[model samples]
Target: MTNHPHASSDAANALAALAAAPAAELEHILSEVCSSPAWAAAVAAARPWSDRQALLAANRAAMAGLTVADLNDAMAGHARIGKPKAGDATSEREQAGIQGVDTALLDELHEANAAYEAKFGHVFLICATGRTAATMLAALRERFPHDAATEAEIVRGELRKINDIRLGRLLGDTA
Candidate 1:
């Protein structure tokens, strides 16, 4: 994949550091990207990636093998769409669309979030990078009727998108 024109020297430095980091340390860093320990360890085991694309491919493969339990572990790290974790820049940035919106919209979104969790038995997850609050609520409502199997598959896809975006931020790829 072509690199972002704004890819900084910091990304290069970070990649080099990641390549040379101890296994435990590397996995720790990766766990922040996607909180599945298996995913982190698997990707870490494939270290010294030749480039961003290689690293991404490794992540994809690891993600493809995740069990339901692994997905649950990863989902634990995410906040609800309208309620980003306080003091977390990453969550704040990803859920920025919820900011400055109508309070009624936010309240309705929170109510919908509770209903979603009650029906699905997990937090509603989405790649909320640039989506508006209303948009997220609509999507959540749309997906609310999916059967368990379909929802699980959709969750995996959303996790993949979130992981890739976080990885892109980590490596300055703008992917």
Candidate 2:
């Protein structure tokens, strides 16, 4: 994975700092990227990453190592898909494509989110960046019939995609 050509100098510096930060601070930073204490602690403990790719690979491995409870904890940090909260810049930006949608579409998304949560006991997680409201809603509908085990696996995959995107963003990748 190549770094974004327009990555800011500050992001590069932040990456370097992250590689050397103390365990507590490192975990704190990693938590901001994905909100699982276990994931944060594991990734942080494996630090002094040689580069962004190495860091990302370790993140993927750490995520894969999590138990169902840990995945649930990570999912708790995300807002419902298509319903970005005020002042949450990360969610707001990630769900930007769904902004300004009509009330009908938003209502459908709301119902779908509730149904998904009722079935899975967690928020519907997706990598919403660059996807339209309709697309997200369609994906939710498509996944509604998945068995519990299947849905759990799907959630894990989505979380991985989200973590990758967030890591890239943390490194100032504008793309």
Candidate 3:
């Protein structure tokens, strides 16, 4: 029962104990473990997990299963401020590699981001891993030109990516 352990011999036991938990308990455990609805819903559906890989596989499968409503619910927990918060815990954890920008730059990005959201009727969505702030800004600018249908699909994809990150974090839970 340490705070950190990776793929330990007891991992299967821990996972089974979680997977066997009742739905309310599952939701509660997973809620503490991960806050995203898409991730939580996916974990909840991953009952009877065979092992860590099975749990991860279920998490991925769940992302693929997300409905538009589910994606929006997942997105609800993230920052959609007129400006992005540099290193916002939720976004940083979910999109650490993908969404970080220099704190100094968020102020400048705010107006353009707001204008883009205003035109699109939804917040800009990016997978936010392995990219720079400037890169993300460029993506936002480019995506702004996309029509609603295209943007909707892109948002859905972004939500799925977030779900994946949350699931990995939760599945990497304490021993």
Each candidate: RMSD: 2.4, 2.3, 4.6
Q: Rate the local accuracy (lDDT) of all candidates.
A: 0.88, 0.85, 0.64
Cα lDDT tens digits, model 1, 1-175, are 2355645666777678788998778878899999999889888888888777788888888888899999899999999999999999999999999999999999999999999899988999999998999999999999999998899999988988899888877776543
What are the runs in model 3 whose C-alpha is more than 4 Å off? Answer: 1-14, 29-43, 81-88, 94-104, 173-175
Instruction: For residues 1-175, write the lDDT of model 2, one tens digit per residue.
Output: 2455545566667688878777777777788888889888878877777777788888889888888999988998899887897899998998997899999999999999999999888899888989999999999999999998898888888888888888887777765
Model 2 residue pairs with clashes: none
TM-score of each: 0.91, 0.91, 0.69
Considering summed lDDT, which 10 consecutive residues are worst modelled in model 3?
Answer: 166-175
Candidate 1 clashing pairs, residues 3+ apart or interchain: none
C-alpha lDDT (0 to 100) for residue 39 of candidate 2:
86
Model 2 RMSD vs true structure: 2.3
Q: What order do candidates take by lDDT, descending?
A: 1, 2, 3
- Name the candidate, 2 or 3, with the larger TM-score value: 2
lDDT of 2: 0.85
- Model 3, range 22-135, lDDT digits (tens) per residue? 888888766653455666777687678777677767766765676766666655555653334575665554444334556666665676679886897656777665556676
